[model samples]
Structures are given as structure tokens and as C-alpha cells.
Target: MNIILAIILLVILPYVGFWKLFEKAGRPGWEGIVPLYNAYVMIKLCGRPTWWFILVLIPGLNILVFIGILVDFVKSYGKFSLLDHILAVALPFIYLPKWGFDKNTKYIGASATAPFREKYKIALKKTATREWADAIIFAVIAATLIRTLFIEAYVIPSASMESSLLIGDYLFVSKVNYGARLPMTPVAFPFAHHTMPLIGTKAYWDGVELPYYRLPGLSDIKKGDVVVFNYPMDADSPLYRPVDKRENYIKRCQGTPGDTLSVVDAQVFINGKAAPTPPHGEMSYTVQSDGSEINPQLINDLHLEDLAPGINNTFTVNTTLASVNALKGYSNIKSIVPTLSPKGMEDPLYPVYPVKFPNYKITPNFPKFTWNLDNYGPIIVPKKGWTVKLDSLTFPVYGRAIEIYEGNKVQVQGTDILINGKKADSYTFKMNYYFMMGDNRHNSEDSRFWGFVPEDHIVGKALFIWMSMDDNASFLNKIRWSRLFNIIH
Candidate 1:
């Protein structure tokens, strides 16, 4: 409904403003009020090929297409100045109608036609200022189109995806893999994502958000694929932003829609089976030594993330199995075991800034379930058309998803669940959801910490690492040349 209103008010009104202008161009005035037909007539007036109209159908590309057509349509009336084109796009409801009413604004000829170019083309050389301005505008538009509709470059800023995707690794996330999601927050500053750099203000307007929509994609997100998605937590609260404008996070898809998933001592089981683990994945381990401090150099060699010395000469470390095996070989090492949280123990860091979760916690929010970080639910991931009984247990697990991400008004009173103001015992999911976990399990702030990632929040599949830089390495050794173009697992 908002999209239709936006089209009627912002889009169709411009064509309505161009009614007289279209009639002057030898087309019927009624054609201007007709949406797609108006664009067709405008293309004819501007002498652009009929195929150029396809741009109007593409979601991300249409913004550029609309502006370009406006510029071309205005130029057909001998309005060639940059200001004229700018107003034609920026204030089309005002300037388009102004031109439509101005008798002096003549339908000179098709804007870019050979005959029109021969007659009205100025012999004066374009000023250096104009050339630079034109170049910058063209570059911005071209880059925006490419970034939106095709592959985009992403840099790993944290060790959440360490090993499989290291910090400082520049990856090419393929939009086409799981389809390019249309911009929900369309009125955003170009290149600036959710926030304006330096100023620390929002870069997008949420007043006119479009619905969650996606173009056709090569494949669906499946298990083991390293995927990039909008951080689902940003859907509400003090950090709320449009889904597309949410912070980008990359993780390995461990559980897909419809699959029941559980974590037992940090090992994920999907649908009653042990899921395939990433070769580079790491997890927390408690390393006990025979009251001896191991060599500091050996600690660095293991590439352990956390190496906090515990009481009784034990060390709580986070590292891959390879590191654990290497540590096992040491003479002073007594034992190394996974630091699993015993069943029902709440994570000490829960419901806080460092550990960002929903408004409520486990027991009070939902039914009493003794689930913790290392040992969690055998919860079913929601799939489209899947219906669940909306009670205390299910509501807490899926309430945020039901009311917030899926766009519904969910209210709980006594023992009754009300969705969209209607008392309902069950709710059908509108979209599929996935479980994402970082390869660096203990260190990663991922789906395990938050919840399931909605299908709409999915961005793209990580294709490969184009560049990798090691910040800790010396200048000469900084370039991780061997990892370049390595296909993401």
C-alpha cells in the first residue's frame, strides 16, 4: 500500500505534471497519466531505443533510469542546462508542470536525434568544471548500479569469521547467488550505508520504506555456504534501522529453513545429525597444564584467539582443533577439553551490550528451558507456510520474528496470544529463516547469540576472497598473496 501510494504521489504525479508536455510532443495527453506508457512515450520523444525501457523494470537500476529519462524528457523541450535537468528529476512535480505550462518551452525536436543535435548543439566547448561534474555524476550512477545489481566488495572488519574469513580479508559477495534484495530503504545517501561517516547521523530516510522484495537468484541459501546478511537484531529498538541499512554480517549457514537445530557442547546438530563443520572453525577450550606456564612463543604459534590464564594453572583459550592438537603435544599440557557451559547455565554476558539479544531473557521471556551458549535448543527454523502454536514457549522463540521482522502486531495477555489484534493460537510464517554461525564459534557474535536470520535479511553468498591483509604482520609480509581469489567454502 505504501509502495502504491509512493508511486501515485512521487512517480505517477510527475507524469501527470508532464501531461501538457506529452501532448505538445505529438502524444495524447491521456498517455501521460498511464504509467508505463508515459515512459514509452517519453523514450520516443527523447529518441532513445525501446529496449532502454527495461531499466524501469529493474529495482535498483530504475532509480537511475527514472532520473536519466527525466533529464532526457526535459532536454526535448530545449532545456539543456544542468539546472534544468536537475530540477526535472529533483522537483519534477514543480518543474515538469512549469515546463508543461510555459508556452516558450517548445517541443524543439527529439533531444538526442541527429537532426536535433545538428541544429541545437552548441559549438562552445564544455567548461572544465562541467566536464568534471559530468564525470563525477556518471561515475556515481554507474558505480551505484553495479554495486546494487551485481557483485559488491566487502571487508571483514572482525574475527567473527576468522580462519574461513579472516579480518582484513576483502571478499566479493555475489548478489546474484541468492538474488539481489531490492533496496527497502531506497532514499539513502549513495555509498553511505546506514550512517553518514564523520557526522554519525543516519544516512537513510525510513519514512517511505518499500516492502522486502528480491529479484530472481541463482540459488537458495543452503548449509555450508558462507553468507552475508543484514544483522537481524537491528530490526528494532534503539539500534533499529531499515533491513537493508542494517550492519552487514557474514557467517556460515549451519541450519536452513524447516530444519530443527541444536547445539550440544558447541557441536551443532541439524535434524538429528551432526552438521559438517568448517575446517578452520574454532571454539572455546579449557587447557589444563601441570602447574607449568607454557612457552609464550608456542601460544602465538597456536593462533589462539583467547588465552586467559585461569585459576589452578589452567588456561581458557579459543582456538581451532589444529591448535588444540599442537598444544596436546606439549610435555607440560595435562589436558585440553572444550569449555562447554553445563546445561541450563545462562551465559554470564547475556542481555547486555557485548551480548546483544532481544528485550527479554530465556526463563522470564519464554518457557523454562535450561539452554545455554554451548547447549541450546532443538528449535525448528521457520519456513514459509509453516504454522506454529503460539503459546508461551513458541511465542518467545518466534515472537520477535512474528511481530517485528514479519510485520505483525503480536500481543500476549494471560495465556492468550494475539497476532494482529486477533486472538490466535497458531501463526503461519510468511518467510523462511536460517541459522548462521561464525567459524570462530567462541569469539563470533552470530545467530547463536541472537536468533534466526530471516530470508529478507539475506544479502548474498560470499564468492571468494579477492584480497587478504594481515594487520599484525610486518609491512612486507602484510599481503596474504596465497589466499587471493580463494573460493569461500
Candidate 2:
């Protein structure tokens, strides 16, 4: 008797729940949970050609079929108007029941078709309609809140900010360190964010100025700070905005508003003051994976090279002139703040100033890029009203200005001001972004080329390392026990 009851519940409940779905599809109620038969009825109600579901398994054409399913499903049931149809497609679960249970008296059919399915077939359903509805809403809400208010997860794919952050290191970025942005683009169906992509053109159709609003969070930004922000170039990827709550980056903030920054001999000097290097723990003379000895300076496998005019060429130093030139270019060592140099300012035109070299190279087994990191800078971060003539330009050194608006839309143009196809004398800024780099130096590709990360793009500061694993390591070395619970300062 128990087995029979279990079978009955399993077979009977879905039909009861999906009876409304059958009616919405213009089919008889009993056809609701009849797998193959209901599929046949759905094809009939939507007026689809036979075997369309089979074609839906095809890669590219599946998208087109899904679209057709949405369109036909809505039109066959007159419960939803045109706008409702659009909203339902973006987020279907919201209108599923309406299509199911609504008593709207219209169901269109061609050539006198009957409403009921002929037979029942068993099939596995992925998720319940109710669960789907809740999941969609939950994901969107959680993504938004985590993007703005709490912590966000990000994976590092490249070695740009290496040493400090490895390629496989996944991070939880905190948004509370700064602040979050309120959701402005509101037309998304509870779960469907598809329409957001096609919404490239702003909805300025209403003719009212949509004033930008910012939800205040952290009070200040500090230099040498490691931060995560949105990628300014690709705002439309997942989050619709360049600086998003969705995508994040981990970098050290080298410049802030109103602060002059310059790098001299690879040393970063902010606002005419020298930036302090993080304290290096004791050095270990262990051999690395590549058979290179891992010494104190090799804690992160840092390579230091001298790019000085007369220094790198010394025979006793055992350095290559080409490597030195590469160091000069990579480190921007010709100028005190090489990264901040304006574009077209490549030649060493500035008067050479004497800089004292640290004795890091004296240590045997020290990497070649050490001297590059030893250099300091003296430059300033741009403020709202500050103006300066840019003679030369440098990539990754300068941060561009951007204006973020209500619709997850953004406009980016910088101080090398261009206006209406002409260059302007001075430019104004809506918000400021900073350039960040990793201590790994040579391995990290950062603001040095892509551009400044705006305040709105900032995701959060990294607080700690909770879990870590290196797939290449042995079982004993798999877990990064020393890094576990380590505070990210």
C-alpha cells in the first residue's frame, strides 16, 4: 500500500501543479505532467514545426528556438500583453503561472485542434518552476548586494599582478571598504538579464535628466593600498558597466586625487614622498621548480635588473645590456615616475638625476629585476581642478576620467582632453580612478596600459586568505598552510 501511494504521489503531484501550465499552453489540464504528450501539446499550442526540441540541441540554433518558444508561448495565450510578453521572456517564471492559471478566455488554434495530450511519458525535470523562480531572483539580488555591500569572488587568470596574487588565486573582494552603487537599471525581469545587453542605447526617450546617485561607503583611499575595481574597458561583459560590482581586479593603489606621483629608478614616490616597501620576511635558499635557487629576494621569484646608463653594463655585474634596456622600458627608469609619463614622452629628455642604488644585487642568487623595483617616483594624482600641460604620455601610468550614469552606462574621456573632434584646453572630471600594480613588478600587467580604475569601478579591498591550493604541488605541499588566514595588508 505504501509503495502504491508513493507511486501515486510521484505521478500525480506534478500533473496537479502543471495543470495551470497546460491551460496556459492552450492544452487540457490532464496533459500538464504527461512528458512526451505535453511536449507534443506544447508544440501544437505554440504552432511549432515537429522535432523543434531536437533541433534545440544544436549549438547556435538552440538560441533561436528558445526565442521562438518564448514568443509563441506568449502570443498563444493572450493573458500577457506585448510588454508583459517581453518581461516574461527576460524572466519567464514570473509569467508561467499567469500563462497557466489565468482565466483569460482566449486560446487560438489552427485547423480545429483538440486540447488534450494522447499519452503520458516519463522524463526527468531539472528544477521545479517555483525553485527556478526563487533561484533567479536570489542570484540577481545576491549578486547586487554582494557587489555593492558585501564581499565578491574573483579569479586571477593572468600573471599581471603576480607574486602577491597568483594566477590561480581566487579572492573575495570586500565592497564595504569603499561603497556600493544602487541598482539603477530596473527593467530586468525578476530573473532575466538578457534584455540588458540589447539596451546599449540609453533610455533618454523620457526627456528627463536622470541625475546620477552614489551610495556613500568608505571615506578615503590610501596610497600603496591593494584594491579591486571594475575593468574600465569592458563594462558590458557581465555587469553592463565598466566599473562593476560583478567583475573585479586586485591591485595596489599608487595614486590618489591631488597627489603628485613619480617613479625614480623604479622606486615609487607619491606626493614627493617615497613609498615604503613591504617588510620582507627571512630569505630561504631553497631550490625552486625551475632549478633556480629561491633565496630571500626570491620569496616571490623577483628578478631585479639595473637600467642605469653606466651601471647595468658592468662586466662584474653579469647583466645583459638588452635585459637592461628591457628593464629601462619595463620599469620606466629613465624618468623618476616612468609610469606616469604622458604618451609620446619616451626619450630620456629630462636631465639625469643621481640616484643611490640599493645593495640588493650584491646578494648572490638575487633576481635581475630587483633594481627595477628599487626605483622611486615623484608624481601627483589628478584632482578635479588641477591642470597641467602633458608633454609626454605613458601607458599604465595615467588614469583616465569617466562619468557613470543611471543605466549602468559609462562615458570615458581623459585629461588629454578631446571634445567635438578637437582638443580642449582643460578638462573637468566627474570621478577619479587610480592605477594599481602588484609587488611582483615585471610579471604584472596593470594600469600601466589599460588605464585608471575609477572609484565606481572599485569592488573592494582584499582582507584575508581563507583557502589556497596549488595543483602542481605534492600532496603535502598542496595546501598553502602558511598563507592560510594570512591578512592581506
Candidate 3:
């Protein structure tokens, strides 16, 4: 049976059973299925204002609403006190039905709450063990609903976004924040968010089954919001790392759609104006023997084989900062090949190091390459209805279309794609890519590395930080009082 249908059966069966029991007590039987109307019937049975339901919507105070109802239920049955309160709350199904159907007690027009202390007291009551046993299951359902549809817990991992979000920061991620994605994978394991038996399976790709369609969340991605998303390479894989077990990273949005973005002298310029940066953060650069290059520090170790001694040069690198910094005092700037330390060397199996250089001069105040993080494109992002054709003439304008080879045989082409020899029409297009970067310029592996991050890979914008901690030096570091309550720009 479908799990939702099973849950409906489990819930409605008892309410119907209680309705029949209410009929035996000379009350309206239809009250059982009317939701809040049933609450009104119980209120009338216990003698209280029906307007009290309004109090149930207040945060934190709603616990008192249920507790007050349970107290009233016990009192209606001529039962009161702490132990009765426990049964009314901890095992409410037994007490609610007992008060409704117990023939031994005659209906007295008893007030549930009297102004004095005596009126609020709960009386002792006894009911069947069956209701007591079902308490755990019912409570589980209530808790599960709140977690699945309202809010959930997530832990933050990595320092991609330091200062704002830290490693080991626990967060209450709202599932409803982006209205719920239909639960396509129904049998998820408890607390893990992984589907059991069919673990690692995805709903659909490109446009297959596409089992889930989520309603839009709070708002679209805003600049500077920390967001968590599925890695573009593989959506089926969990975002969290096992060691931290939160989504893999928390990064600030540096660019949004339709923005003409460029980085000049380590200061990001959006549409020909300098972007405001945080008061305190580092501006990273690529340094040569002569001077420094101002740019977004490329944190990925890139070793393309075109510019080294070996016929096949491969870069096993830690990061790649472009030499795009203009010499502030000098008109002409130049870069010599950098000498690597012992630790910077790579082995034959994993041939890293000695980055290949193109025959291009390092010029001051000029955009170096077409798509470095700091010197990226004038290419406008394609929105819906924008058509694209992949031919040699138009391919370069979109992006480079190069064929990668394995053992002198072409395996893949530009934009991480391949052309099948047998079928010339087998070329496939991937999703549209967007540029993403970190606020902390020196440290971030973003669109600059493996190319642009697809727009579909965007999760949601990071909202406000409810809490903050200083975990840089030690666990006991003092809180950053200045940063507290500060809005993420």
C-alpha cells in the first residue's frame, strides 16, 4: 500500500472508532471527522470557549495549548493532578476516549478552568493499555510531519565560507523554505535522508521520469547569500562530507545572472563599478619574481600539458592564480616561469606541475584570458527560448569546443562533451552554466576551475545567520560580537 494511504488509515480508523464511542454517549457522531470542529466538541464536552484554538498558532506557546486541552480532558472525567496530567499528555488517546465514552461518569456541567487554583487541577484516570502503546507511534507521526514539511537539521562543512559559516556549525535548514519537493524516493532511511535499497538512485536526468517538481523557495539567489547545493558533477551523491556530514560547502554568491562581472586588481567590478567587500578579508594574487598579479586566486591545481618540457604535460596543482595584476607603477608587466619547491613536484602516474603557457604576453590593465575568474567573459547567459546551434562557426563564440584524447584517440570534446563517430547526430548539450565565487577571494574552488556551475545546480540563496561562533583558534574562542546580527550583503 502507499505509505500516505496507510497513514490515513491508521489515523482515521481510531477517530471513527472514537466517533462510534461518542455516539454511544449521546453526542453528535459526525464531530469525529470535522478536524477543528472535533476540537470544539471536546471543548463543549469540557465547557470552554472555542476561541482558544487561536492560541494554538503562537510559536512555543502552542505546547501549552495541547497541555491545557489534555488537562481539561482529565478534569471532564473527574480526574486531575500531575500524574493525570502526564497521562493526558504522554498518553492522550486513552484519556481522550475514556473521558468521551466512560458511562460510569455522568455528564455534569463542570467548568474546565476556574480562576482559583482548585479549578485548574487534573483528576486521576485509568484507560486501556492499547492506547498507551499507540502513543509512541502517534507521537512519531507528529514529529515526522514537522521535520519533513517544516524545518530540519543540517551541519555545515568546509571553510569555503569562513567567518560567516564555519565547519561544525549546526543549522536548522527549512524544507518548506523551498516548498516541498514531492517525496519521489518514499522509503528514505530514518534521519539519514538517503533512500533505502535504492540508495544512490536519482529521480531523473535531463528530462526523464522527473518524479519531483519543487515549488519555488523563499526567493531567487541573491548576491552574497550562502547556499548549499548538489555538486554539479553528480546530483545523486550526498552534498555532505562524511567527516563533517553537512552539505559539502557553504559559499557566498559572487555573481548572479545578467551581471557583467570582472575582477580588476583583486577588487571585483560588476557592470564597470567596484563591488563593496567586507571590511576584513584577504585579497589574493599570483606573484612572480618581478611583481604581483591581482586576480581571484584560483585554488585548483591546474596543469594543462601544452606549456611544459614533456610532450604530454599534465598539471597536478593546488591552485591557479592568473598573472593579471597590472603593475601600478610600471606600464609594462611580465611573468617568468615559476620554479617549484620539492613538495610542488608531481610523479609520473599523477604528472602534476609546470603549467603549460600560451604564447600570450602579461599586459597591465588588460583582460588576460576570456574566462579566468578575474578576466572572464562578455558572454551573456542564455535564458529560456534562446536557441543555440553547435557548428564550428558558432562554437567558439559560445565557448571553446576542443576534443580531448586518450592514447592519441579523441575521447571527449569541448564543454566536457564528445561526438560519437558512428552517429554524427549524437552530440548532446548540457545545462547552462553560471559563474560562482567566494567572498573570501584567496580561497575558493568555484566556476574558475571545472568551468561554470550550471544554473539548475543552484540550491537557494543563503539567508540570515541565526547564530555565529569563533572556531578559528579553539573551541572556546570568544564570539564575534561585532559580526552578530550583521546582514549578509
Best by TM-score: 1
Q: Which 10 consecutive residues of model 1 have the lowest summed lDDT?
A: 348-357
Give lDDT tens digits, candidate 2, residues 54-75.
8666533444455556555555
Which 10 successive residues of model 3 have the least lDDT summed?
A: 401-410
The models' CA-based lDDT, in order, is: 0.82, 0.47, 0.44
Give the runs in model 2 whose Cα sits over 4 Å from its true position: 1-136, 183-213, 233-247, 280-378, 387-418, 421-423
Reference-based TM-score, model 2: 0.48
RMSD of each candidate relative to the true structure: 3.0, 17.7, 13.0
Kindly give the number of clashing pairs for every candidate.
0, 52, 14
Q: Across residues 1-489, which tens digit of lDDT does each residue of candidate 1 receive?
A: 777866765677676677889888888899988877788888989998889899888866777887788787888888887777667765686787778888898787777678777787693236788788778877887887778878899999988887778889999999988888878877788999999999999998887778788999989998999999999878768988888999999999999999999988778999999998788888778889999767878877788646888899898887888888989999999999987777667653233313333333334445665566677788898999999987777777787888788888877777777778899989889999998988987678887668889999998999999999999899999999999999988
Model 3 spans with C-alpha error above 4 angstroms: 1-153, 168-184, 194-210, 236-248, 258-275, 278-281, 285-370, 392-434, 451-458, 467-487
Error of 2 at 226 (Å): 1.1
Clashing pairs for model 1 are none
Q: Give candidate 1 misplaced runs (Cα > 4 Å).
A: 1-5, 33-40, 49-69, 90-94, 123-125, 291-293, 348-366
Model 3 TM-score relative to the real fold: 0.44
Q: Which candidate is the best by lDDT?
A: 1
The window of 10 residues in a row where model 2 has the poorest summed lDDT is 116-125
TM-score, per-candidate, Cα-based: 0.90, 0.48, 0.44
